[model samples]
Target: MKLPYLPQDYSKKEHIIILSILLLFAFTAFLLTIISTTGSTSDYVPLTNIYLGTADITHINVTKVVPQIGPILAILGTALTAPNRTLDNIFDSLKTISETPALVPLMYLLSNAQNVSQSLISLTQLAPLAISGNPATDTKDLVEISGLLKVSSNESQTLNGLKNLVVPMLQSTNTSNKEDRTTELTLDLLADSKDPLTVAKSLTVLNNLTMEEKMKMIPIFTLFGVTKNITSLIGSLETIVSKGDAISPARSELMLTTLQTMLASNPNVTMAFGTISSLASGDDEKAAIGAIQTMLEDSNNVNTTLSSLSTLIKSNVTQAESSKTSLVALSSIIQNVNDQSKAVTTIAQLASNTDTATTTAQLSALTEMLKATEKGTETINILSQLQTSLNPNSTTFKYIPSLFTLLDASADPPVSFSSLVTLTAWAQQNPQTFIPIMGILSDALAVKMVSEDQLTEMTPTLLEYLRIPVYFQLSIFTLCKRNLEKDILECSASHAVQNLDFRQIIYDALSASEFAPYLNALNIGPNDLYLEGDLLNREHEYVPSIKAVLAMNILGIVFAFVVMINIGFLFWMKWSSKSYAWVIVIFLSSCTALFLGLSCTVLTVVLQVIKSGTYKDAFGVVFTTGVAYSAMMWCSFSLMVISSVVLLWVGITERHLRIPYLMKKNPATIEDLENSSTEADNAIQETKHEATPGQIIRHSTDNSSDFLKNDPDEKQDAVPDIQQTNTSDSS
Candidate 1:
């Protein structure tokens, strides 16, 4: 009955304790399952509720089936814990097991579950400051807003003074003229200004215009117009302000006179002479003429000369005798300059062709002369004298109108001068006087200075700028984008400027700022959320939204599968009988499974608690969730504790204090048993020969009792053992 080498503690007591614990765990888990199934219709416990074609089999429940899962697993795991195989070997086998058809699918399930949980957390956290509660709605609004800004930015610059003013002027409503509405809105924005009340006074002059006055307003507001005497002029003074120019009293007076003179002289001007005449007094007209004369006489009047040439070019020369006469005189002067080297040709090419290359070269020459001359006034005087020379009758004029009949043959400007090479050569050789004069003339046109009329026209255009909503919304989008790009508080900076309140940009324009007057005039207010701020605030919902609930469910299933895999692996190891450290592996593995399963299940219930907010419902959910968690935890814990105790019993009971069946040789074979029987027989014979019959009987009974104690199944063979024990030798 005795084995050659058995683990000391391998016994019925040890097996009984382990099996008892597994039975208790299985029973408790089954009880919980029943309670959960019957308690509430809404409650859906994961492992217990797995439905497969309505078999309704209780044994199929993985959690309750301890004999197949936990005990078998522990046994296999215990056998696997030999001194040869290690935990690392177990882990390697686990990785290999992951390739199994059943387990591989669980990996993806677990991964997806984790993603759902994390994504729900992010959404709830970001929902607070988002433009709308619905993410799709907010995203649509953002796209629309982006489109609006794109169009506004492109179109905002194209609106000139005249175009900006004309639309509002023609827009008449039942309540007020659209122009007046625009002005009123602008006025309200300026209502809280710390400065003097100039806004109302300025708008009053515009609002007082009659129908005829409004008609007159049209022609005088063009930006650049070609004329008879004045070649090019800005139609309005308002452009000066819009372009951010400084306008002193002297500059203002000079602008006003210059505008009047230019308008009166421009034969191609659309405005009537009488209207142009009416805009300036007789004295103002004379002063303007004097200012033009003085500016010309000072030798810095290339501006005036170019203006005259542009006007002559634009004139109705084909129809008007006066324009033809001026052109004739201009041609004669150009011919006179040609006598002074090929410089005149460069000048002619610059003026007629308006070639950028020729113009740039000429301008560069003038810039050099100005730099060399150092005294800007002296350079201006020199250029002004050159300009005067263009006027054939001036005392400062160098070229006089000649009596050459051949010159009049080409009344119109020349079409072509020289080739690209020759023109460049001409510009290079004639760098001194001719090039500088041409340069000065070209420089004069580049700045595009506005006239007083243009300056006055900008008032209405600016008012329109204030009324447009995209103007501010675009600014907010830009600010937020910047803040996002930089990851900083760029939006918090104040941007107010120049009686305009140009700064302090935000997401929703109507709701923010001191520009409430404009909002009121347009009938938008704090209640109107037309402009939405699409920022995500820090606050999140206590419970993740409905989306989160779905995520939790997915994760729970994943956790359940994970726990099952570990239990399955444990059973495989136990069945293999290769492991000596099964007790520790079972204990640790069960704890890990318990932790994963219980944590995820409890988290699902926690999410529900966050949603309902009612303590009554919360308590019920919490209780159910707790019970489920406890059952799983207890199942794993009991498996681990009982499995470890059984292994320890084996360790304590074994004589060799090592695993049973580890040694290669077996000492309990037939040949070894026969030899042991012969030795027993000889020892018995010696005892019979030396001892009395009573001692022999006593000794034989003692030997039989010892043998029976060792082998419980051999109790029936005890009488035969005494009868065959050499009684004749003892007698």
Candidate 2:
């Protein structure tokens, strides 16, 4: 306790000394600042900033720093080179690990990690400067440089999101017989484990363990249980989540999964989900529930899991409503099949509660549960019962259109085009139920086009419904066809070309395929013959005017037939009686030339009319009328000309009374007639008694007799001389 210097002297000397030291410190500080101020600031922008009075200038804003600071840092770092021997040991161990063929990559990983670790130590060397000096950035840079060697997510973030060289392996939780010794060491440092070396040894034991050996570690985790290490695991979870690490989702998922599995086994991991759920609401709630639901859905303890879910649900009833609402499907999915009755009922209650949010997702989920009703009679019946409770329009059909959307996925069994078709089918099956959907479809059509696949998918359903009432088909045909255009345009870049086929298909389908049925049922035609002056009748005007142009051929034939009939009938009538027969003669003579002349004149007129230019309006009808009239005139003229010629010939022949005339055709010739006159000299007295003074004569008994009978024979010379005298006298 005795002091080498006396207390008072010691005090005075120390006080004076302390004052001198303080003064000296102030002086040197001033000198350094003055020197720095006098210097050029080509290298330091901050000095220029200080000169401008834009920033605070400082003493360490040195006019010059030792150019060798880089080597100085190296040399200073070497003074603690023995302390850094741990890094060497680490490097050598890493080298050994590297050269160890099997662990080489991991060794390189560790080597880089060692560099990062060394850099961290180097940053420690810069700590005083970082903490107490304006060069804090430099210190921070050193820290960052250490971290940049690539490792850890938090370290990554800290080190400008520094990566672990073997990041996937590094962040990965190893649970093998030969465990990740690095991870074990990290845990030892991180966890404050009771025996870090033992824990370290345990990590080595894990690494050497085969997959089978790794299996042995399960009980260890199982025994340690999730609850035992909940805090640490959650911390890691929180770290990953907070850092928003690139693999956060995956990492968090794994962490959560592990927590869930461990908790499910021990019935304790529910805490984490519970913790997460409490902070979340709405979409967040569903997510938390989803996390736990995945775990609980598979647990052997169905009751426990459901109870946990129910418990989780109760914590935030809104969340429970949400989770239950969401998990209803997932519940059905992963929940024990045996517990489905209970689960489904729970799901039904959640679904039925109108108080719950009707978000599209909620609506979708509720609809989906109804869709998934394939398993049990009880489940299906319950769903059916629940369906009855909601508004037919507001609750069920309100979302039937979404079912059509789900068709896009075209999942097998449930998600096929047929599934979408089924919705349409259901709409058709119960038209009243899905009428709104048609309207929705209409609106949808108005926005973007539908695809033909979608149309084809729904065609049967639409057709089936439309077939019931013809009015529906006719009215909806335009819609169906137009929407089909929309359908085709869905994929095409060119809207113009898109629906061309659709127009043809739909137009043809209704216009042609359904033409008869549609027209018949509606009692409509292009011209309404049956609509005779009904109230809706536009106007009624009836005038008997032949469509002469169209009917020209018909009219001509008809007139010709009439003329022929009149002629034939009159001829027959006249032949039956002489009084009528005279009528026939007069009729034929008067009408024949007139009809023929009229037809010829009409023909000429029509030919002239047809030769002119096209009809301005009525020329066609006028021309056709002219043609028909001309045809009638010509036909009459032709018949009359032939008839007149025949009658005149008959009269002339009838006036002649010679033998040839009796025959009227011929009696060989007139010479024969003259010879017959000589022969008649014998029979003339006997046969001269023909009626109307008609004469009959034989030409001769024989050819020679006719010549000789008129001439004198040699023995009849005397008779001939008398005959010659009589002949001369007669001449």
Candidate 3:
């Protein structure tokens, strides 16, 4: 239906009131937009600056004055907008004030600035302005104003100020009017502010009110959309509870009670189960957990809580991943309850679900709960129950096999590790039950290796496969040493032999030739092996000698030493210069051949050892080709070959000696020698002419300065002196 319109034959006073209400509404809408968009009232300063044509303004304290104006305008608008002079229409108009979104920020502004006292006084004085001379309409307006005063009476100052204004107003009203006033105040408080502290304080006040008053407020809570957005209500309660020591125990209890009442009153509020679970499990807040526990213990609420949790755990994978922490917390809480059979059954169903998405979180939460629970008959009983729940079709079955299936299917390392840890702990408690699971473990390992090509990519998988046997063997040995009365070695060895057979599983799995490349990628050595002959009861046949390995290492060290000594000797004798490039080339080439031979021998020994089944079946023996040693040998060989080629090039060019037909030229004749001598003379003359004073000075400083002699034209003197000496010898 369309809203009632203003009468056309209106008085000037009525017209003024209508215009004022419209203007107030437009202004309130604009302010709400600004606060909602920017999330702060400080944004108002920009508009203020724009209107005033000033930019220097830093802050405008609208907190005190604006809140007072909103309620006054609301009362005035409601009182004037009533179609008839009746209490019902005026009350109806007043209810619309609670629906106004702008009142939330306005109420929050007053609450934050601690200006509730002043705002209440202003609203109280303006309450009379809403009187339209009708006794009933005036009485309803006074009751509303009284409710506002009561809701705002949270602080001592505000409460004291409310007494003078509220007592006289309430005395004039009857019981129903008092209830109506309480309802008005409750709605005004609950519906107007979304601030956690304000909501929490409102709940506190509601809790202190009489039972009738609280019951009256419940429907208002639902009608005003408070229960529809129950997550926010729960969130506000969590904010109060999270304050820890800052909040009193009484206040916390009131908050929890308020929550319980909301949950009980509205079944629709249960849709916030995810949020409730998160709050219960997200923090170790006693109040939150207590409230949840109370709900679970109640016969009426238990099913709802359990069903919500189960649905969350069984939700799609994305929800499951995000709910991991919540599930873990729920599991922990369930443990403390008297009968957790249903909860345990729910978690087991999640764990057994074929959907891999939810299994990761389910298994993690279940395993962590199992680990945290103390081991005893209680633990055994829980496991037994879980086994039946997990494998409902089988009569005489163990959960270990189901766990293996889940473990194999899961690619997450944490899930896999947790499963293994649970198994290990269970084995420690019940060794007999663990005995049958050993074969299951072996089968699982084999399946894992076959299905997963990059097992090494998972550190847990690699460690479980390669290192678990050694760790287990050592653990057994330690246990034997501690418990056995005599013959510790014999006792340990006897028991260890039985356990060491599991190593055969690993050996058999890795024996496939296709695994060689993967194994070689890992630095597996003799230490990682369990030699065949070293078994306690086996006959010694092949000892797997390392003499070849030793010989190769010795030869490599000797060659390296020889090369170093030869190079040092050449340098000391001054024979490694350009004239002796051939000598260096020979030395480097010989070293290269020796390194290459050593590298080949090492590789041959390693490959032969691997092929001989010694590397695979060797028990309690360390055998490796020494990956670092082999790499070093190859690198040394490469360096020597490179050096040889470089030195050969230097020797060929520096000495200017050509081999065979590559250099076919005659020796220098006398005329050719003379021409070279004349060219040298001309070069010297050019150098003398072009020399700077500094160049001459540097040349003169040298001890050998024959080229810079005082006589520039004294050329061919050495040649003439040589000719005279030859003539004298002939005479």
Compared with the true structure, what per-residue lDDT tens digits does model 3 show for residues 703-729?
212331422332111211222333343
* Model 3 alpha-carbon drift over 4 Å, by segment: 1-549, 565-574, 577-581, 611-627, 656-682, 693-731
lDDT of 2 by residue, 2-91 (tens): 101111112334323432433333233223323222212222332222110100001110101111111212222232133333323322
How far residue 340's Cα lies from its native spot in candidate 3, in Å, is 77
Alpha carbon lDDT of residue 505, candidate 3? 31
Candidate 3 residue-wise lDDT at 611: 32
Q: What alpha-carbon RMSD in Å does predicted model 1 have with respect to the real structure?
A: 32.6
lDDT assessment of candidate 1: 0.30
Clashing pairs in 3: 526-622, 526-623, 527-622, 530-618, 530-619, 531-618, 531-619
Q: What would the per-residue lDDT of candidate 1 be over residues 272-293, giving only the tens digit for each residue?
A: 3335445544554534334333
- In the order shown, the candidates' Cα RMSDs to the true structure are 32.6, 50.4, 43.9
The worst-scoring run of ten residues by lDDT in candidate 2 lies at 52-61
Least lDDT summed over 10 consecutive residues: which range in candidate 1? 51-60
Off by over 4 Å in 2: 1-427, 430-514, 521-523, 526-586, 589-641, 652-731
Models ranked on TM-score? 1, 3, 2
